[model samples]
Target: MNEQISLSAIKNGNINAFEELFRSLYPPLCGYALKILNDSDLAEEIVQEVFYQLWKKKEDLLITSSLNSYLYKAVYNRSLHLVEHKQVENKYANHVLNDNSEIYSIQDAMQAGEIYQIYKKTLSQLPHRCRKIFQMNRDFGLKYNEIAIKLSISVKTVEADMGKALKAFRHSLAEYK
Candidate 1:
Protein backbone atom coordinates (compact mmCIF):
# COMPACT_ATOMS: atom_id res chain seq x y z
CA MET A 1 0.00 0.00 0.00
CA ASN A 2 1.09 3.60 -0.65
CA GLU A 3 1.73 6.20 2.06
CA GLN A 4 -1.61 7.92 1.83
CA ILE A 5 -3.47 4.64 1.81
CA SER A 6 -1.59 3.44 4.88
CA LEU A 7 -2.29 6.74 6.62
CA SER A 8 -5.96 6.45 5.78
CA ALA A 9 -5.92 2.95 7.16
CA ILE A 10 -4.26 4.21 10.30
CA LYS A 11 -6.82 6.97 10.71
CA ASN A 12 -9.47 4.33 10.29
CA GLY A 13 -7.93 2.31 13.09
CA ASN A 14 -6.33 -0.34 10.93
CA ILE A 15 -3.70 -2.12 13.00
CA ASN A 16 -2.16 -4.03 10.09
CA ALA A 17 -1.37 -0.87 8.17
CA PHE A 18 0.17 0.66 11.26
CA GLU A 19 2.32 -2.42 11.70
CA GLU A 20 3.38 -2.25 8.08
CA LEU A 21 4.34 1.38 8.41
CA PHE A 22 6.29 0.66 11.57
CA ARG A 23 8.21 -2.20 9.96
CA SER A 24 9.02 -0.16 6.87
CA LEU A 25 9.98 3.11 8.55
CA TYR A 26 11.52 2.27 11.90
CA PRO A 27 15.01 1.31 10.69
CA PRO A 28 15.72 4.37 8.54
CA LEU A 29 14.25 6.72 11.13
CA CYS A 30 16.37 5.14 13.87
CA GLY A 31 19.47 5.51 11.69
CA TYR A 32 18.67 9.13 10.95
CA ALA A 33 18.21 9.88 14.65
CA LEU A 34 21.45 8.02 15.49
CA LYS A 35 23.38 10.25 13.10
CA ILE A 36 22.21 13.32 14.98
CA LEU A 37 22.38 11.96 18.59
CA ASN A 38 25.51 9.74 18.27
CA ASP A 39 24.10 7.37 20.87
CA SER A 40 22.45 4.19 19.69
CA ASP A 41 20.20 3.76 22.70
CA LEU A 42 19.03 7.38 22.74
CA ALA A 43 18.49 7.35 19.00
CA GLU A 44 16.34 4.24 19.30
CA GLU A 45 14.39 5.78 22.15
CA ILE A 46 13.72 8.95 20.19
CA VAL A 47 12.48 7.00 17.18
CA GLN A 48 10.29 4.83 19.35
CA GLU A 49 8.85 7.91 20.97
CA VAL A 50 8.07 9.37 17.57
CA PHE A 51 6.26 6.21 16.58
CA TYR A 52 4.42 6.03 19.85
CA GLN A 53 3.24 9.61 19.52
CA LEU A 54 2.24 8.99 15.93
CA TRP A 55 0.11 6.07 17.02
CA LYS A 56 -1.40 7.89 19.93
CA LYS A 57 -2.31 10.98 17.95
CA LYS A 58 -3.12 9.39 14.67
CA GLU A 59 -6.63 10.81 14.57
CA ASP A 60 -5.82 14.52 14.61
CA LEU A 61 -2.62 14.41 12.59
CA LEU A 62 -2.58 15.90 9.15
CA ILE A 63 0.09 14.47 6.88
CA THR A 64 0.64 17.25 4.35
CA SER A 65 3.94 15.87 3.18
CA SER A 66 4.92 12.31 2.62
CA LEU A 67 4.75 10.23 5.81
CA ASN A 68 8.45 9.67 5.37
CA SER A 69 9.12 13.39 5.51
CA TYR A 70 6.98 13.86 8.58
CA LEU A 71 8.63 10.97 10.38
CA TYR A 72 12.16 12.16 9.55
CA LYS A 73 11.39 15.68 10.70
CA ALA A 74 9.97 14.34 13.95
CA VAL A 75 13.06 12.26 14.60
CA TYR A 76 15.40 15.16 13.84
CA ASN A 77 13.53 17.54 16.15
CA ARG A 78 13.41 14.97 18.95
CA SER A 79 17.14 14.27 18.60
CA LEU A 80 17.97 17.96 18.84
CA HIS A 81 15.74 18.36 21.89
CA LEU A 82 17.46 15.41 23.58
CA VAL A 83 20.89 16.88 22.86
CA GLU A 84 19.85 20.25 24.25
CA HIS A 85 18.40 18.67 27.39
CA LYS A 86 21.61 16.70 27.92
CA GLN A 87 23.63 19.89 27.61
CA VAL A 88 21.52 21.56 30.29
CA GLU A 89 21.93 18.57 32.60
CA ASN A 90 25.71 18.49 32.11
CA LYS A 91 25.93 22.20 32.83
CA TYR A 92 23.92 21.79 36.02
CA ALA A 93 26.17 18.94 37.17
CA ASN A 94 29.31 20.99 36.50
CA HIS A 95 27.82 23.93 38.40
CA VAL A 96 27.10 21.72 41.41
CA LEU A 97 30.61 20.26 41.34
CA ASN A 98 32.22 23.69 41.15
CA ASP A 99 29.96 25.12 43.83
CA ASN A 100 30.77 22.42 46.38
CA SER A 101 34.21 21.04 45.51
CA GLU A 102 36.25 22.86 48.16
CA ILE A 103 35.84 19.89 50.44
CA TYR A 104 38.20 17.32 48.99
CA SER A 105 37.50 14.93 51.87
CA ILE A 106 35.12 14.61 54.80
CA GLN A 107 37.62 16.20 57.20
CA ASP A 108 39.18 18.66 54.74
CA ALA A 109 36.07 20.38 53.49
CA MET A 110 35.33 23.86 54.76
CA GLN A 111 32.48 24.62 57.14
CA ALA A 112 29.04 25.09 55.62
CA GLY A 113 29.14 28.85 56.11
CA GLU A 114 32.60 29.08 54.52
CA ILE A 115 31.51 26.98 51.57
CA TYR A 116 28.38 29.13 51.13
CA GLN A 117 30.55 32.19 51.24
CA ILE A 118 32.78 30.85 48.49
CA TYR A 119 29.76 29.94 46.39
CA LYS A 120 28.29 33.36 46.89
CA LYS A 121 31.55 35.03 45.95
CA THR A 122 31.97 32.95 42.84
CA LEU A 123 28.39 33.55 41.75
CA SER A 124 28.76 37.28 42.32
CA GLN A 125 31.57 37.39 39.81
CA LEU A 126 29.30 36.44 36.92
CA PRO A 127 27.56 39.06 34.77
CA HIS A 128 24.09 39.87 36.05
CA ARG A 129 22.16 38.11 33.27
CA CYS A 130 24.55 35.20 33.19
CA ARG A 131 24.21 34.72 36.93
CA LYS A 132 20.43 34.76 36.71
CA ILE A 133 20.38 32.23 33.86
CA PHE A 134 22.78 29.99 35.73
CA GLN A 135 20.69 30.25 38.87
CA MET A 136 17.51 29.41 36.97
CA ASN A 137 19.20 26.40 35.44
CA ARG A 138 21.20 25.10 38.39
CA ASP A 139 19.01 26.08 41.34
CA PHE A 140 15.57 25.80 39.74
CA GLY A 141 16.43 22.91 37.37
CA LEU A 142 14.92 24.61 34.32
CA LYS A 143 15.85 23.40 30.85
CA TYR A 144 17.50 25.71 28.33
CA ASN A 145 14.32 26.17 26.34
CA GLU A 146 12.32 26.77 29.48
CA ILE A 147 14.82 29.34 30.69
CA ALA A 148 14.77 31.03 27.30
CA ILE A 149 10.99 31.27 27.33
CA LYS A 150 10.91 32.44 30.91
CA LEU A 151 13.48 35.13 30.20
CA SER A 152 11.91 36.00 26.83
CA ILE A 153 15.24 35.22 25.14
CA SER A 154 16.34 32.87 22.41
CA VAL A 155 17.60 29.39 23.12
CA LYS A 156 20.90 30.33 21.51
CA THR A 157 21.17 33.23 23.93
CA VAL A 158 20.48 30.91 26.84
CA GLU A 159 23.19 28.56 25.59
CA ALA A 160 25.70 31.36 25.19
CA ASP A 161 24.91 32.68 28.67
CA MET A 162 25.31 29.20 30.12
CA GLY A 163 28.69 28.79 28.40
CA LYS A 164 29.83 32.12 29.73
CA ALA A 165 28.72 31.23 33.25
CA LEU A 166 30.51 27.88 33.16
CA LYS A 167 33.69 29.51 31.94
CA ALA A 168 33.55 32.03 34.74
CA PHE A 169 32.97 29.29 37.31
CA ARG A 170 35.84 27.24 35.96
CA HIS A 171 38.24 30.17 36.00
CA SER A 172 37.27 31.26 39.51
CA LEU A 173 37.04 27.78 41.03
CA ALA A 174 40.25 26.34 39.64
CA GLU A 175 41.86 26.53 43.07
CA TYR A 176 39.26 24.22 44.55
CA LYS A 177 40.32 21.46 42.19
Candidate 2:
Protein backbone atom coordinates (compact mmCIF):
# COMPACT_ATOMS: atom_id res chain seq x y z
CA MET A 1 0.00 0.00 0.00
CA ASN A 2 2.85 2.38 -0.70
CA GLU A 3 1.49 5.71 -1.90
CA GLN A 4 3.51 5.60 -5.08
CA ILE A 5 2.04 2.23 -5.99
CA SER A 6 -1.50 3.39 -5.25
CA LEU A 7 -1.06 6.67 -7.14
CA SER A 8 0.31 4.82 -10.14
CA ALA A 9 -2.67 2.48 -10.09
CA ILE A 10 -5.08 5.38 -9.76
CA LYS A 11 -3.52 7.27 -12.65
CA ASN A 12 -3.70 4.10 -14.70
CA GLY A 13 -7.48 3.77 -14.13
CA ASN A 14 -7.54 1.46 -11.15
CA ILE A 15 -9.78 3.53 -8.91
CA ASN A 16 -10.04 0.99 -6.11
CA ALA A 17 -6.36 1.47 -5.42
CA PHE A 18 -7.26 4.63 -3.58
CA GLU A 19 -9.12 2.62 -0.92
CA GLU A 20 -5.88 1.57 0.64
CA LEU A 21 -4.52 5.07 0.34
CA PHE A 22 -7.59 6.48 2.00
CA ARG A 23 -7.44 3.94 4.80
CA SER A 24 -3.80 4.70 5.46
CA LEU A 25 -4.08 8.49 5.37
CA TYR A 26 -7.54 9.22 6.73
CA PRO A 27 -6.61 9.53 10.42
CA PRO A 28 -3.72 11.96 10.08
CA LEU A 29 -5.71 14.07 7.67
CA CYS A 30 -8.59 14.20 10.11
CA GLY A 31 -6.22 15.05 12.90
CA TYR A 32 -4.83 17.96 10.90
CA ALA A 33 -8.37 19.18 10.30
CA LEU A 34 -9.26 18.85 14.02
CA LYS A 35 -6.54 21.35 14.86
CA ILE A 36 -8.60 24.06 13.16
CA LEU A 37 -12.13 22.70 13.52
CA ASN A 38 -11.66 21.11 17.01
CA ASP A 39 -14.64 18.84 16.38
CA SER A 40 -13.84 15.17 16.01
CA ASP A 41 -17.01 14.25 14.14
CA LEU A 42 -16.70 17.24 11.83
CA ALA A 43 -13.06 16.44 11.21
CA GLU A 44 -13.92 12.87 10.26
CA GLU A 45 -16.68 14.08 7.99
CA ILE A 46 -14.40 16.52 6.22
CA VAL A 47 -11.68 13.93 5.73
CA GLN A 48 -14.21 11.43 4.41
CA GLU A 49 -15.58 14.04 2.06
CA VAL A 50 -12.13 14.87 0.76
CA PHE A 51 -11.54 11.24 -0.10
CA TYR A 52 -14.97 10.89 -1.63
CA GLN A 53 -14.31 13.90 -3.84
CA LEU A 54 -10.92 12.61 -4.86
CA TRP A 55 -12.38 9.29 -5.87
CA LYS A 56 -15.30 10.92 -7.65
CA LYS A 57 -12.91 13.04 -9.71
CA LYS A 58 -10.08 10.59 -9.98
CA GLU A 59 -9.86 11.00 -13.74
CA ASP A 60 -8.29 14.44 -13.30
CA LEU A 61 -6.15 13.64 -10.31
CA LEU A 62 -2.62 14.95 -10.37
CA ILE A 63 0.08 14.34 -7.81
CA THR A 64 2.99 16.65 -8.27
CA SER A 65 4.27 15.73 -4.83
CA SER A 66 3.11 12.98 -2.51
CA LEU A 67 -0.51 11.92 -2.32
CA ASN A 68 -0.47 12.34 1.45
CA SER A 69 0.33 16.03 1.13
CA TYR A 70 -2.47 16.50 -1.39
CA LEU A 71 -4.98 14.73 0.84
CA TYR A 72 -3.87 16.73 3.89
CA LYS A 73 -4.15 20.04 2.05
CA ALA A 74 -7.53 19.13 0.61
CA VAL A 75 -8.95 18.16 4.02
CA TYR A 76 -7.53 21.30 5.63
CA ASN A 77 -9.06 23.52 2.98
CA ARG A 78 -12.43 21.79 3.22
CA SER A 79 -12.50 22.16 7.01
CA LEU A 80 -11.65 25.85 6.74
CA HIS A 81 -14.41 26.32 4.19
CA LEU A 82 -16.91 24.60 6.50
CA VAL A 83 -15.93 26.96 9.34
CA GLU A 84 -16.21 30.04 7.08
CA HIS A 85 -19.60 29.01 5.75
CA LYS A 86 -20.85 28.59 9.28
CA GLN A 87 -19.65 32.10 10.02
CA VAL A 88 -21.54 33.63 7.06
CA GLU A 89 -24.69 31.74 7.93
CA ASN A 90 -24.35 32.80 11.54
CA LYS A 91 -24.01 36.42 10.46
CA TYR A 92 -27.36 36.25 8.71
CA ALA A 93 -29.04 34.32 11.49
CA ASN A 94 -27.89 36.80 14.12
CA HIS A 95 -30.21 39.34 12.50
CA VAL A 96 -32.36 41.32 14.95
CA LEU A 97 -34.79 38.72 16.27
CA ASN A 98 -36.44 41.16 18.60
CA ASP A 99 -35.58 44.17 20.77
CA ASN A 100 -33.44 41.86 22.86
CA SER A 101 -30.42 41.36 20.54
CA GLU A 102 -29.33 40.07 17.15
CA ILE A 103 -28.98 36.34 17.75
CA TYR A 104 -26.40 35.78 15.02
CA SER A 105 -24.88 32.35 14.57
CA ILE A 106 -26.03 28.76 14.80
CA GLN A 107 -22.51 27.32 15.14
CA ASP A 108 -22.14 27.50 18.89
CA ALA A 109 -20.92 30.47 20.97
CA MET A 110 -17.18 30.02 20.32
CA GLN A 111 -17.41 30.49 16.56
CA ALA A 112 -19.40 33.66 17.00
CA GLY A 113 -16.69 34.97 19.30
CA GLU A 114 -13.99 34.11 16.75
CA ILE A 115 -15.88 35.80 13.94
CA TYR A 116 -16.29 38.94 16.04
CA GLN A 117 -12.59 38.92 16.87
CA ILE A 118 -11.65 38.65 13.22
CA TYR A 119 -13.98 41.53 12.33
CA LYS A 120 -12.57 43.65 15.13
CA LYS A 121 -8.99 42.90 14.20
CA THR A 122 -9.54 43.71 10.54
CA LEU A 123 -11.34 46.92 11.45
CA SER A 124 -8.41 47.85 13.68
CA GLN A 125 -6.02 47.48 10.76
CA LEU A 126 -7.94 49.99 8.62
CA PRO A 127 -6.85 53.63 8.43
CA HIS A 128 -8.52 55.48 11.32
CA ARG A 129 -10.65 57.71 9.10
CA CYS A 130 -11.60 54.84 6.85
CA ARG A 131 -12.62 52.74 9.83
CA LYS A 132 -14.80 55.54 11.17
CA ILE A 133 -16.52 56.05 7.85
CA PHE A 134 -17.10 52.34 7.45
CA GLN A 135 -18.63 52.04 10.91
CA MET A 136 -20.90 55.00 10.20
CA ASN A 137 -22.06 53.51 6.94
CA ARG A 138 -22.46 49.95 8.17
CA ASP A 139 -23.43 50.44 11.79
CA PHE A 140 -25.61 53.54 11.47
CA GLY A 141 -26.59 53.03 7.82
CA LEU A 142 -25.57 56.55 6.92
CA LYS A 143 -25.56 57.82 3.37
CA TYR A 144 -22.23 58.69 1.77
CA ASN A 145 -23.02 62.39 1.60
CA GLU A 146 -24.40 62.30 5.14
CA ILE A 147 -21.24 60.71 6.45
CA ALA A 148 -19.20 63.32 4.58
CA ILE A 149 -21.06 66.22 6.20
CA LYS A 150 -20.89 64.55 9.59
CA LEU A 151 -17.14 63.90 9.31
CA SER A 152 -16.43 67.27 7.62
CA ILE A 153 -14.64 65.43 4.81
CA SER A 154 -15.66 65.37 1.15
CA VAL A 155 -18.30 62.92 -0.03
CA LYS A 156 -15.63 61.52 -2.31
CA THR A 157 -13.50 60.80 0.73
CA VAL A 158 -16.33 58.87 2.28
CA GLU A 159 -16.74 56.84 -0.88
CA ALA A 160 -13.00 56.24 -1.09
CA ASP A 161 -12.74 55.19 2.54
CA MET A 162 -15.62 52.77 2.09
CA GLY A 163 -13.83 51.25 -0.86
CA LYS A 164 -10.62 50.85 1.14
CA ALA A 165 -12.49 49.30 4.03
CA LEU A 166 -14.20 46.79 1.72
CA LYS A 167 -10.88 45.84 0.11
CA ALA A 168 -9.31 45.28 3.52
CA PHE A 169 -12.20 43.12 4.70
CA ARG A 170 -12.17 41.02 1.55
CA HIS A 171 -8.41 40.54 1.75
CA SER A 172 -8.49 39.53 5.39
CA LEU A 173 -11.37 37.09 4.91
CA ALA A 174 -9.78 35.52 1.87
CA GLU A 175 -7.13 33.97 4.12
CA TYR A 176 -9.76 32.46 6.42
CA LYS A 177 -10.62 29.94 3.75
Candidate 3:
Protein backbone atom coordinates (compact mmCIF):
# COMPACT_ATOMS: atom_id res chain seq x y z
CA MET A 1 0.00 0.00 0.00
CA ASN A 2 1.13 3.62 -0.54
CA GLU A 3 2.50 5.60 2.39
CA GLN A 4 -0.31 8.16 2.04
CA ILE A 5 -2.95 5.44 2.28
CA SER A 6 -1.18 3.80 5.26
CA LEU A 7 -0.70 7.16 6.98
CA SER A 8 -4.34 8.09 6.49
CA ALA A 9 -5.47 4.71 7.78
CA ILE A 10 -3.16 4.99 10.83
CA LYS A 11 -4.50 8.50 11.46
CA ASN A 12 -8.01 7.07 11.38
CA GLY A 13 -7.00 4.42 13.93
CA ASN A 14 -6.85 1.44 11.59
CA ILE A 15 -4.69 -1.27 13.25
CA ASN A 16 -4.23 -3.26 10.02
CA ALA A 17 -2.90 -0.21 8.17
CA PHE A 18 -0.52 0.51 11.03
CA GLU A 19 0.77 -3.07 10.87
CA GLU A 20 1.23 -2.77 7.11
CA LEU A 21 3.23 0.45 7.54
CA PHE A 22 5.41 -1.19 10.20
CA ARG A 23 6.08 -4.24 8.05
CA SER A 24 7.06 -2.17 5.03
CA LEU A 25 9.10 0.60 6.66
CA TYR A 26 10.74 -1.16 9.64
CA PRO A 27 13.58 -2.76 7.61
CA PRO A 28 14.57 0.36 5.65
CA LEU A 29 14.42 2.47 8.83
CA CYS A 30 16.65 -0.01 10.69
CA GLY A 31 19.10 -0.05 7.79
CA TYR A 32 19.24 3.74 7.74
CA ALA A 33 19.88 3.84 11.48
CA LEU A 34 22.52 1.12 11.23
CA LYS A 35 24.41 3.22 8.69
CA ILE A 36 24.49 6.08 11.17
CA LEU A 37 25.05 4.18 14.44
CA ASN A 38 27.24 1.26 13.28
CA ASP A 39 25.48 -1.10 15.69
CA SER A 40 22.71 -3.37 14.50
CA ASP A 41 21.05 -3.72 17.89
CA LEU A 42 21.09 -0.01 18.65
CA ALA A 43 19.88 0.81 15.15
CA GLU A 44 16.95 -1.58 15.49
CA GLU A 45 16.19 -0.17 18.90
CA ILE A 46 16.13 3.40 17.57
CA VAL A 47 13.82 2.47 14.73
CA GLN A 48 11.49 0.63 17.11
CA GLU A 49 11.40 3.59 19.47
CA VAL A 50 10.56 5.98 16.62
CA PHE A 51 7.75 3.70 15.51
CA TYR A 52 6.47 3.44 19.09
CA GLN A 53 6.47 7.20 19.47
CA LEU A 54 4.69 7.58 16.15
CA TRP A 55 1.94 5.23 17.30
CA LYS A 56 1.64 6.76 20.76
CA LYS A 57 1.43 10.35 19.42
CA LYS A 58 -0.40 9.63 16.19
CA GLU A 59 -3.41 11.78 17.03
CA ASP A 60 -1.34 14.88 17.79
CA LEU A 61 1.42 14.42 15.23
CA LEU A 62 1.79 17.06 12.49
CA ILE A 63 3.68 16.06 9.33
CA THR A 64 4.41 18.59 6.61
CA SER A 65 6.24 15.97 4.57
CA SER A 66 5.84 12.33 3.65
CA LEU A 67 5.79 9.68 6.41
CA ASN A 68 9.04 8.24 5.03
CA SER A 69 10.75 11.61 5.38
CA TYR A 70 9.44 12.05 8.94
CA LEU A 71 10.66 8.59 10.06
CA TYR A 72 14.08 8.98 8.44
CA LYS A 73 14.56 12.38 10.06
CA ALA A 74 13.55 11.03 13.46
CA VAL A 75 16.01 8.12 13.24
CA TYR A 76 18.82 10.39 12.08
CA ASN A 77 18.32 12.84 14.93
CA ARG A 78 18.12 10.09 17.55
CA SER A 79 21.31 8.44 16.27
CA LEU A 80 23.15 11.75 16.38
CA HIS A 81 21.91 12.38 19.91
CA LEU A 82 23.17 8.99 21.08
CA VAL A 83 26.58 9.61 19.53
CA GLU A 84 26.84 13.03 21.18
CA HIS A 85 25.82 11.63 24.55
CA LYS A 86 28.44 8.86 24.31
CA GLN A 87 31.15 11.37 23.41
CA VAL A 88 30.23 13.48 26.45
CA GLU A 89 30.41 10.44 28.73
CA ASN A 90 33.85 9.49 27.39
CA LYS A 91 35.14 13.04 27.89
CA TYR A 92 33.90 13.04 31.47
CA ALA A 93 35.63 9.71 32.13
CA ASN A 94 38.93 11.02 30.78
CA HIS A 95 38.63 14.16 32.91
CA VAL A 96 38.07 12.10 36.05
CA LEU A 97 41.08 9.91 35.30
CA ASN A 98 43.33 12.92 34.75
CA ASP A 99 42.04 14.55 37.95
CA ASN A 100 42.71 11.41 39.96
CA SER A 101 46.27 11.14 38.59
CA GLU A 102 46.96 14.75 39.54
CA ILE A 103 45.66 14.18 43.05
CA TYR A 104 47.77 11.05 43.43
CA SER A 105 50.91 12.90 42.32
CA ILE A 106 50.26 15.67 44.85
CA GLN A 107 49.75 13.15 47.62
CA ASP A 108 52.98 11.37 46.68
CA ALA A 109 54.95 14.61 46.77
CA MET A 110 53.51 15.55 50.17
CA GLN A 111 54.30 12.11 51.59
CA ALA A 112 57.87 12.34 50.27
CA GLY A 113 58.32 15.74 51.92
CA GLU A 114 57.01 14.36 55.22
CA ILE A 115 59.43 11.43 55.04
CA TYR A 116 62.33 13.77 54.23
CA GLN A 117 61.52 15.89 57.29
CA ILE A 118 61.43 12.80 59.50
CA TYR A 119 64.75 11.63 58.03
CA LYS A 120 66.41 14.99 58.73
CA LYS A 121 65.14 14.94 62.31
CA THR A 122 66.51 11.42 62.78
CA LEU A 123 69.86 12.43 61.28
CA SER A 124 70.10 15.24 63.85
CA GLN A 125 69.79 12.68 66.65
CA LEU A 126 72.72 10.55 65.37
CA PRO A 127 76.29 11.03 66.70
CA HIS A 128 78.41 13.43 64.60
CA ARG A 129 80.62 10.77 62.90
CA CYS A 130 77.67 8.46 62.12
CA ARG A 131 75.65 11.38 60.66
CA LYS A 132 78.62 12.46 58.47
CA ILE A 133 79.24 8.93 57.18
CA PHE A 134 75.55 8.37 56.41
CA GLN A 135 75.33 11.69 54.57
CA MET A 136 78.46 10.89 52.51
CA ASN A 137 77.07 7.51 51.49
CA ARG A 138 73.38 8.40 50.91
CA ASP A 139 73.25 12.12 50.08
CA PHE A 140 76.61 12.45 48.33
CA GLY A 141 76.27 9.00 46.67
CA LEU A 142 79.72 7.83 47.78
CA LYS A 143 80.86 4.19 47.97
CA TYR A 144 81.92 2.73 51.34
CA ASN A 145 85.60 2.60 50.19
CA GLU A 146 85.43 6.22 49.00
CA ILE A 147 83.93 7.38 52.30
CA ALA A 148 86.55 5.45 54.29
CA ILE A 149 89.37 7.00 52.20
CA LYS A 150 87.87 10.53 52.43
CA LEU A 151 87.39 10.33 56.21
CA SER A 152 90.81 8.64 56.86
CA ILE A 153 88.94 5.75 58.54
CA SER A 154 89.05 1.98 58.09
CA VAL A 155 86.31 0.44 55.89
CA LYS A 156 85.15 -1.58 58.93
CA THR A 157 84.60 1.60 60.95
CA VAL A 158 82.57 3.12 58.07
CA GLU A 159 80.44 -0.04 57.85
CA ALA A 160 79.82 -0.04 61.63
CA ASP A 161 78.84 3.66 61.56
CA MET A 162 76.48 3.05 58.62
CA GLY A 163 74.88 0.13 60.48
CA LYS A 164 74.37 2.26 63.61
CA ALA A 165 72.83 5.08 61.54
CA LEU A 166 70.47 2.65 59.79
CA LYS A 167 69.41 1.10 63.13
CA ALA A 168 68.62 4.53 64.52
CA PHE A 169 66.61 5.58 61.48
CA ARG A 170 64.67 2.31 61.46
CA HIS A 171 63.83 2.66 65.13
CA SER A 172 62.59 6.24 64.80
CA LEU A 173 60.76 5.76 61.49
CA ALA A 174 59.09 2.42 62.21
CA GLU A 175 55.74 4.08 63.01
CA TYR A 176 55.34 5.29 59.44
CA LYS A 177 55.35 1.79 58.06
Best by lDDT: 3
Error of 2 at 69 (Å): 0.6
lDDT of each: 0.73, 0.69, 0.76
**Can you tell me which runs of candidate 2 are displaced by over 4 Å?**
87-177
- Clash numbers, per candidate: 0, 2, 0
**Clash pairs for candidate 3:** none
- By TM-score, is 2 or 3 better? 3
lDDT of 2 at 103: 27
TM-score of each: 0.49, 0.46, 0.48
Q: How many backbone clashes does candidate 2 have?
A: 2
Where model 3 places Cα greater than 4 Å from the true spot, the runs are: 87-177
Runs of candidate 1 with Cα error greater than 4 angstroms are 87-177
Q: Ten consecutive residues with minimal summed lDDT in candidate 2?
A: 97-106
**Model 3 weakest lDDT span, ten residues long:** 103-112
As a TM-score, model 2 comes out at 0.46
Per residue, candidate 1 scores C-alpha lDDT tens digits across 1-177 of 787899899988898999988876676666665655567887788889998899899999998987767777787667666666664233343433444333222223222223444566779888899999999999999999999999999999999999998887777666664
In model 2, pairs of residues that clash are 94-103, 94-104
> Residue 62 deviation, candidate 2, in Å?
2.2
lDDT per residue as tens, model 3, 1-177: 777888888888888988877776677667665655567888899989998999988988899987867876787678667765663233343443435345223334334434555776799989999999999999999999999999999999999999999899998788775
Q: Predictions ranked by lDDT, top down?
A: 3, 1, 2
